[model samples]
Target: MKQKLWDHQLRARELKREALRKYGSTVCVSPCGSGKGTMIADDAIGAVSKGHTVQISVYRRILVEQIAERLQLNGIRYSVQMPDLPDKPWAIRDQHADVIVSSRDTMAAILRNGGEVRRSDLHIIDECHGFETLGYQTINKAVQPRWLLGYTATPVRPDGMGLSNRVFKSMVEAAKIEELIEKGMIVPVEVYVPVKTAKRRRSGLKISANGDPIQQWMSHAYGLRTVTFCSNIAESKMVRSEFVANGIAAEHVDANTPREEREAIFTRLLLRETLVVCNVGIADVGWDFPALECVQLLTKCGSPIAYWQKTGRVARNYLDEQKSRGVLLDHSAAMAEHGWPNLSPLWELSDREPIQKRQQERFGESAPSDAKPIICNKCGRGSIGLRNCPCGNPLFRDSQEKPETAGENLSLIGDAAEFAVGKKNYQKEWTNILYMAANHPTGSKSFAWAASIFKNKFHDWPEKFSVTPTVPFDERKRSIVEVYPQFMRRREAV
Candidate 1:
């Protein structure tokens, strides 16, 4: 087997052994890029060696695969028990694997009504910050564990609720982001903030009424590689189109897209073949993009927790020390509320003062003198126009960039001779484009149970419910859907 332990991973292993031996349950608050997955894998191996079955649960679909790969490389045998996994639900239940990974939502659904879990089974909750919410309360209560481990970079939610101290035991083991940089694990970030414009009466609220985060972020997109995160899908599409109009080849992705397309877009990004990828909710978790340099947080996420998660997407140390710094285009209302440097134990919030307009204008390039006023092609709301409509979208002209065209053909159906599907293409290309989505796995059958339980609970449109794909579209594109006529011509000529 490969020796896959880092110094940080070793430290986490020591802590895990101590936590299980002493408290039987513990919470570890670690920052992003800190190799939390490696720690989990090693700990799970230790548990399995002691005849304990381990369950590792996370928030997103991609996390399961990431953890599984680490476990496999460690010479540990494990099974992924999730709704989207290829195997049937719990096929390996009686045949216990060293570790079983799942999504938190699927676990919530299973525990909501009823599910079988042994008292001796270890439960590891990744992205434990999400458990602070209400829906997770029921699942948290139902868990019967031999030991529980909660992991998160950010624990406190903006809503003021926190993970029950009972679950985490308050024994957190962590390393700061700066420390990771010094250790050569994460790159030191260089931050740039642009001057924002005001939102007029007829103008759409791009960031806020006074702080135009949208215009500020867009102005800096002079052919730089970027990713912009928004609050909703509609908003993500609108933002992507605005960038396209400005000459950036931008794409947007939400939960509504098929699994195959999501995989392809993620692959293209890693190849640096795509520029900007705008998103609503999905990109904040397990997805990795080494080419990711600049991130525009145009949306006003209600909590510091969401902000940090978005920032982590671009924080990975990709060996390009030249691209060390990350720019936070805080056009939204965060500056007036949470302030800069947010709540990080790594760096004191008071250490870095908020950048005022006077300071920002001097540090970076100033807005162009004849900068064309951004007119919402959808509603025709100019930069000098009103706030957003009651519908939450800008009441302006129709967008010139069609959402469909903004994405390359993501439908993965075709004749086998012309297309090739693999893990690399899925992660680097499909995940970044507009209209592609990856399904979170809890268990193959758990989604139905979750869907039934959460139907009346969440604001999700029931009509939007459909079977999600587990692998990337391009990986088996020709196998899943019919080849588009556009690609068909190339295949025929070949």
Candidate 2:
């Protein structure tokens, strides 16, 4: 049975055909979970129907198997070319098959070893962001197919190199992220950044020193199936251990984990037996789990490609009625550095300058000048280009006074005599102050910090009042704590 193509997929096919006619080879850029594999299968099937051979190359053995499954479902006869493993009944080595699904390393080795190389009418490269590698270049030189197609969610490279004149001469862009979300092809993401800054390593890579990941998960995405991308194997294991210690079921997997063991862990994750999977590099590409509701980035992503791929894990729509959207808990400040996931930059088929040079030439700073994210203090939601946060809180104020001066000049709503006369009103005011402290962006402040602020204002401790925090209704109270830094400085002094 042939799978039906969506409207966008059909349009992409037309664009790819036109590109191939003009340039002989083109890269197709589409969002993750937008059925790139389906398009690949469709193209392969079309070529096979015309009595032409097709060669599909992937970076990972797992992807080879996945592509094979898609070909099988489409009723296309194919053979697999992986490195190791005994010959199976389903995956037999056949050089004469109409479609050959192969790992890039295996194909490169075949060409290097002077093994049999089958010529194909169509060549499809999966995860084609890595097309600039020497291995892929070697395979291309050997096979030299009639029409070449490369597919990836991210077309740009981490090193700012271009693929235009090198290999792919043209690019076919598919649906935008916002269009996919509107059409219900992918879920919208709600991104949240911790209220703390990232620490710089000696190598210049930033590692998040934000608040505890487990606590953040508990507050934002508790009981939701999640995948945590860690910086290293040790960090991944530590994160898994912390999650397990906090009574959340979690499993850790890295490149070294055995194939069978990794499969078992993934099965448990799909079965909901495990709530979270902390992985390093394994779940970054081509690993699909539609039920994932949350993505926690404990790893700092230096490349925008990596940042998009890591966050795309949770963008797939789930069938559960309760799962309406995806949540991104960005502890590494990736959101702050790379803007939102849905904002698309103008992709080109030309060489890109280094990030520092680009930033310096454009903004005169090393940081991204456009779409600077501002986190809402009330809900901790990160957004860009919005006057008010989605939680209905004002993200910015109209005042032009400096924060130091703002704090020094402002006092409570009432005089000291009125504050003394009404103890009930004083306690209400104290509750509002504690609320602002708890919701501060520099990570939640301690109760002692709030108590100090209360004492500084009322000339006494708030022991008689309830310690519970509530949102302050008065605009002055909210601005004094958030806009003015004197409250934070006072806490440090105390």
Candidate 3:
């Protein structure tokens, strides 16, 4: 039996086909875990069925192997172009295979060695955000395929540069992150940022094993399968050591780690024998673990692309009931800078100016004001525009109570008087008010009175709340009655 593509995937394929027909080259942008591999396989299979050859180019050897596995699973004959080790009997270079998956470095080396690589009718570049690099440019120039297709979750580069009009003439975007979550294609995320820790200055070159990250994890996501992204090898190793000292099963891996050792560590994590894996740069891409529950950020990410990629690790849905939603622990306060990962920003295909210039133009010297996230004083969970924290704590607290910070300014959402109660409690309170108003002696006029009172109390319209009026009794009734006059006076003032 063949795998079926999702609705969004099918739409993306149709759009790509039209774009390719018009522009001869296009890149498809979609969120992580949005089935890019499946789409690539489907496209390659379709092209092969039409008697056209395909070449899939990737930056990493791991991606090459992963794509090869997908091709084999689909019963498609393919060849590999990677260095070292013996090749499969059927994957010989001279054999005419349906597709050829090659790493950029290996292809560059082949070109450097004065060897020729077979050009294909269609070329697919995975992680094509790096197409501006020399290796990809060289490969593109060498192959010169009739049609080009690049795929990436993020279309922008680290320096805020776009990939349109330079290499790929057009781009096809898939469903946004919020759409995927709503469609149950991916899990929702709850981000938490410490109030005090957000003020502490972090060194970019090194990370101290101060046990703060582990403490945060223990408080919020204890015993959950997590992946911690660190600044460097030394920091990752130290962080892993700290986790072990704290009696948590942890492993560390880097680019230099042997393949066998890294595979063993990953296997342990998959089996839940290891609770966390600390790494630097290795797990950013080409690694997929659906069961991962939390992504702890220990490194400050100035680039939005890197931040999104790191946070996307935990966004994938898992089968376990315990893994209902993903958790992001921002120890580095990257959330303050990059905003929530789920929000869809305007993605353009044209080239962009420097990041600093763009930021200066959009927002003065600081980060985007709209992207600022509110922190829960009680549980330290970070959210935006929610009256209640996921931990059931109220967003607004005593204004005088300041968080203990190092030396930097503390960033809070708003004053205590802004959001006085949790969303659930507010809804119930308003429902009771509406019920009382409907039964009041004023009759139809009472509903208008209640609407005015609710708007005054919550500073927003009550249309979004439940229409089924709930009556309050006992102590709740007394509280409502006491505040009723105050609500009336505020309504009268208007």
Which regions of candidate 1 are displaced past 4 Å? Answer: 84-94, 109-115, 132-143, 160-164, 194-221, 320-323, 333-343, 346-494
lDDT, each prediction: 0.51, 0.67, 0.68
What RMSD does model 2 have?
A: 12.5
Provide TM-scores for the models.
0.61, 0.72, 0.72
Which lDDT tens digits does candidate 3 get at residues 108-223? Answer: 89999999988899999988888875368778878889999998887888876777587899999877887887777677665655444442321122322222777667554555
As a TM-score, model 3 comes out at: 0.72
RMSD of 1: 17.6
- Could you tell me the lDDT of residue 106 within candidate 1? 75
Stretches off by above 4 angstroms in model 2 are 73-75, 83-95, 109-114, 195-207, 320-322, 354-393, 397-494
Please report how far candidate 1 places residue 224 from its true position, in Å: 3.4
Structural RMSD, model 3:
13.4
Runs in model 3 lying further than 4 Å from the true structure:
69-75, 83-94, 195-211, 320-322, 353-382, 387-404, 407-494
Clashing pairs in 2: none
Residue-level lDDT tens digits of model 2 in 1-494: 77899999999989998999899999998788788877888889888988988889887676676667778887788888877745645566665678998888898888778897787889898888887653676687677799999988877788644465678899988778878877887876766554334112211344444657887776555556789988889999999999888677899998889999998998898776888999888887777778887888887777867878889988888765434467777775555455455544456677755332342232222435333434445544334456765446687523212211111111111111122324335554564565546545454556566666665444455664544333333432344445444444423111
Q: Candidates 1 and 2: which is better by TM-score?
A: 2
lDDT of 1: 0.51
lDDT for 429 in candidate 1 is 23
**Candidate 3 lDDT for residue 327:** 71
